[model samples]
Target chain A: MILKVENLNKSFGGILASRNLDLQVEEHEVHAIVGPNGGGKTTLMAQLSGLSKPDSGKILFKDRNITPLSTHKRVHIGLASSFQITSIIQSMTMLDNILLAVQSLQGHSYKFWAPVSGDAGMRETALNVLENVGLGRQADTVAGKSSHGEQRQLEIAMALALEPDLLLLDEPTSGMSKEESGEMVRLLKKMKGEKTILLIEHDLDAVFALADTTSVLVDGRILATGTAEQIRSNPKVQQAYLGEETA
Target chain B: MFKFLENLPARVYLAVTALLAVAPLLVTLGSQPFYLDLLTRILILAIAAVSLNLIIGFGGMISLGHAAFIGIGAYCVGIPAHYDIFNGFIHLGLAISCSAAFALITGAISLRTHGLYFIMITLAFAQMLYFTFVSLDEYGADDGLIIYQRSDFNGLLNLENPTTLYYTVLVTLLGLLYLMHRLVHARFGRVIIGCKHNEKRMQALGFDTYRYKLTCYVISGTICGIAGFFLGNFTNFISPEMMDWTHSGELIFMIVIGGTAGIFGPVVGTAFFLLLEEMLSGLTQYWQLIFGLVLILLVVFGKGGVHGLLVWADTRQTAQAQPENDS
Candidate 1:
């Protein structure tokens, strides 16, 4: 398994976020987690990404436990995530946004005297990542001024720049229009098998189209785990979740 | 309604800086030692503002203990002179190391708390240093210490001559400005600004933002310490007054008025503030009252600052050119 969560639990003051959650994601596969709102998809992803520590659990990635790590430590060890709300450095240029991520992956940015633009190799790599996201021409555009769809794509491009072995995508198409959503789906579909992706998405169409396996998370536990075909027809899953949404 | 100076082109900024570089000639022609001395103080203070701008303006770390660094630098000069060792090289080296060390220690602890909490902690530290300096009876305690001899550069540069000192300050200001400009465009600078804009995002992308902020803070202290060294040479005095919290607020005010975004905004802002204070003080003993009122008016009327006004004008001009496309 590329990722394994063993009996993980987390709670707030009075509410449980993740309750004895256990899951596994095989290498080079798209694992989609779908749940009703507040079902703790984000909390699980957070624990895995090290945004917050679990109350008690072991989160193993490639057989190495990473539950004790911090957010940046997880990133340094080939795990990267894109935020649901687009955590972008808004005041900076789009190229600058991606270039910062690129610079971080390359190592410490202690080169004070040399201009970032003067490094032809790093600049071209940043530009290529931007182009892949279809933001090639808007390289110099201020990130905040970019359209909502562009910002979402830029968010992923930053994660991609890390060259992570595993990518955590939290609602990659949130707040996007149908057309923009289609573009994002196509992008993710094209990127499948290139790396292991743990996708947390609400769009049922996207999950069905892209996921090799779908895990139904309800009340902080995996209700069912199966292929799209198996999960679609499973009476328990439909009665619990798919039935409510489709109803 | 176009005010020529208000709507001046970008090139005029360079011209104004150039004009200040030769202001010594104009002052000497007028045979005014007082104005020369005042302008020299402006240059030195401008250096501190520029250095402060590196962390506050670019790095977005609102440090309130900046004057503490200046005090540390002044002591580097004052303490050595008190011991009868007046070498320029030794003074400069001491200023850099001591202030940088203070920044490192204070910054490590202080950077852990951000925003208003960060401000208060830094202020508390600065006040601690101020009181500590106040208790040093060997350095004249609360009264302050006077330098009997200026830093000797082996007859290479005369710190004693007012004209030489004024020109010396101007050149240092320009040189430091160039170095800082180079810095803000560098990769390290990009990380600092990125962290300011969205620290969580920067960290998630794998940059150790804590170390970056601490480094910027240390560099700022080291640079401000250089300004302190100059301040000691100019005034021939060092005291706890130099490290007061109010003086740190004044440095912040200068940057705000000049627009911290541009490379020379802090310097330009320093010039505006000190010149206004000098003119107002000459006219009235109640200059501070008038100055406070004008500063309030400036903050309300000026959006972003003087440099921001220029940026706004540039954007408006572009919008005018592409009228159909934008709106």
Candidate 2:
């Protein structure tokens, strides 16, 4: 197992976001969490990414407790995330955005005199990552000026640049059109087996297409965990989530 | 060569430097040495504004207590000269270290709270320093102190000469501008800029942004402190008034007026502000009323200040020229 969460509990005032949640993500498998809106999918992702502290839980990455690590420290330890709402430095170029992520994993960025733009190795790595995301031609385009689909692609590029051991994708295709969603799924499908991915997705087609094991979450708890074929036929998962989607 | 000259800001930077370089000769020929003195004061404050721009413009740190560093720097010189210590190196060393230490301590606290809270906390720390200086009766208290002599460089350069003093201040400004250019383009600078755009994003990307911002704050304070050192020598006096909150506001005003995007913005802003002050104060006793109106107009209509205006004009020229070239 690459990630293990034991009895994770979190709440906001009276709203239980997580309740004795237990999950285990094996190495080199795409684990998808599907649920209705406000079913605490994002809340769980936030806790996993170290953005929010779980009220009670033990989060083990590689069998080492990382429950109390800061967000950046978790990233340093090879866990990176893409947010549900696309987040990037809008004023900077596409290449610069990826360069920042690549720079983070290399070492300390306390270098004061040498220009970052002059670092040929960093430039090449950033360009290669952008090219992998099919954004090679738009390297110089300001991120804010790019299309929504492109921004979503940039978000994944940035996350991949960290070369993380596990990638946490929170609704990567949330705002994408049908065509864009297909493209995103194709991209994620290409990344299969090569990466350990914990995907929080709403698109059932995408979940079935990319996830090796699908888990149904409802009312702050996991209803069931099984293969896509099993999840589609599981009565509890249908009544809690999938049935509502079809109805 | 032509392509490089086509860049508006570069051309302006060259023209401004050349003009300032020969300013002493021009003033002497006109027999108005007072203009040179005024220009010297402008250059000193311009240094402070440029340093302020590093934190505010590029780093997205809006500190309202920048003048406190200037006061700290000036006093570093004044207090040393009081005891008959005239070593230039000692004065500069104290100025850099003292201001840097002050910035490091205060920045740690101020950076914890962001936006309006950051501004208030920084202002509060500066006010504390201002009051501390004011209460020291031994140092002449609120009335301030007089420096009997300029910092002795042991005959390396005579700051006693007004022309020499002006040149020294000018050189310092130029060196600092170059330093700012290098810093903002460097790895350290990129981190600070990224933090400004989105601190949360920078953190998620694995940067300890607080440390980077604190380092930036210290560097800025130290540079402003250097400016304070020159101010003390130029005026032959030092007082708490130099570090008053109003002066801090003026430093920010200079940056806003200059167009905070480019390195030269602060210098241009400082020149515009002082020249207008000189011209308006000569015209009326209540020059501040007119100045306030102009500032309001600039903020309301001008998107980027004076530097923005130059950029806009340059882009328009390029657009007009592009069609002719195509034809």
Candidate 3:
């Protein structure tokens, strides 16, 4: 296992966002989490990525306690995540955005007076990541000008640039067209066995299509965790998701 | 060759700066001490404005107490001279140190708060410094202090010579502008801009943004201190009014007018603003009213500043012409 979360609990004022949540992610597998809206799926990812603090919990990445670490430290230690709402430096070029990710990973960000665009090494790596995400041709385009799906792809490209051992993708297909969603599914499939991806997804078809194992969350608590086939047959998950979809 | 022509704006900027470089000689040819003094003041302020643009324009920090750094730098020179310490290097050292320390302490505190709160806290700190200077009765209090002797180096680049000082200020401004250009395009610059756009995203990508912002703040203050040193020498006097909140507002206005889109904007904006001030004040007693009207119109009508307007015009013309050609 590459990640172990022990009794993680977070509360925002009167509401509990994560409640005694215990989970584990094995290395080199695409593990997907499917949950209802407002079920604390994103909140869990936020804590795991160190964007928000858990009220009480121990988050261990590669067996090292990461609960106290910041988002950047988590990134430095081979943990990367994508935002559900598409976080990117929109004013910058698509290539520059990815380059910034790659630049941060390299940790020589204090290189003053040397042009970042002229950095052939960082640029090449960013381009490769862009190409991997099918956005190589849009490298010079300002990210803000790109289509919504393209910006989502750019965000994923940035996540890939961190070269994280475990990747957390939050709603990668949110607001995407059917075709764009298929493309993203294919992209994640391509990287499936090569990286450890903790995916939070809304589309059940996508979860069934890509997730090796699945965890179902309801009201900030895990309802079930098993192989996708097992989770599909599980009566509890059916009541949680199938009932919601029909309603 | 085509690339050079393609960048017409840059080319125009180059031509303008070349003309500015020769301005001192032009003053000599015209035998106009007044023009020389006006231009010298403009260059020093240009340097200060360009530095402020680094923090405000690029870093997304809206500092309202920027003039405090300038005042501190000027005092670094003026205070030393008042006590009969005339070493130019000592003055410069003091200026840089004081400005850096001020930036570090104030930036550490101010950066913790954001937006209007951040702006107000900075203004409040500057006012604190302003009042301290106002209380220094030994240093002439509100009446201000005059330097009997300018800073003297070991007979190197005597700052007293008008032509030499003018050229020196010009060269320094140009150098600082180029340096800023290089800095904003560098790796550190990308992070700063990245933070400006979405600090959380930058942090998510593993950048310690707070440290970067603080360092940038210090560098800006230090450079502004350099300008303050030059301003003190240029005027042969210093005052508490130098760091007034209104002066900081003017610095912000200068960058905004220049478009803050890039390095050249501040330089051009400084020229446009200071020259407008000189021209306006000469025309009427209520020149400020007219100046305010012009600034309001320019800011409202010109989205990104004067440079942005120019770019907008160029794009509009091309966009219009392109359809016609295709049709």
Tens-digit lDDT track for model 2 on B1-327?
477787887899889999999999999999999999999999999999999999999999999999999999999999999999999889989999999999999998999999999999999999999999999998999999999999888888899999999999999999998888899998889999999998888888999888999999999999999999999999999999999999999999899999898899999899989999999999999999999888788777887987888899999999999999999
Itemize residue pairs with steric clashes in candidate 1: none
Where is model 3 chain B poorest over a 10-residue stretch in terms of lDDT? B1-10
Candidate 1 structure quality by residue, lDDT tens digits, A1-247 = 8889999999999788899999999989999999999999999988887788999989998889888988888899999999998999888899989889888888888878988888889889999999987899999999999999999999999999999999999999999999999999999988888878999999999999999999999999999999999999999999989999889
Cα miss at A108, model 3 (Å)?
Answer: 2.4
Which residue window of length 10 is worst by lDDT in model 2 chain A? A236-245
Sort the candidates on DockQ, descending order: 3, 2, 1
lDDT of 2 by residue, A1-247 (tens): 9999999999999999999898989999999999999889999999999899999988999999999998999999989999888889999999999999988988888888899899999999999999988899999999999999999999999999999999999998988999999999998888999999999998889999999998888888888988999999999888888787799
Which digits, one per residue and each the tens of the lDDT, describe model 1 over residues B25-139? Answer: 9887988868888888989999999999998989889988788888988899999999999998899899999999999999999999999999999999999999999999999
Q: Write the per-residue lDDT of candidate 3 for residues A1-247, one digit (tens) a residue.
A: 9999999999998899899998999999899999888888989999999989999989999999999999988899999999999999889899999999889888758877989878788889989999999999999999999999999999888999999999999989999999999989999999988999999999888898999989998888888999988987888888987676866
Question: In DockQ, how does model 1 score against the reference complex?
Answer: 0.80
Per-residue lDDT of model 3, residues B1-327, tens digit only: 557545546766788799998898888899998999888888899999999999999999999999999999999999999999989999999999999999999999999888899899999999999999999998989988999877888789789998888998999998998898889889989899998899999988999888999999999999999999999988999999999999999999999999898788888888899999999999999999999999999899888997787677667877888899998
The model with the greater TM-score, 1 or 2, is 2
Per model, the share of native interface contacts recovered reads: 0.82, 0.78, 0.93
Q: List candidate 1 stretches off by more than 4 Å.
A: B1-10, B317-327
Cand. 3 TM to true fold = 0.97
> Comparing to the true complex, what docking class would candidate 3 get?
high
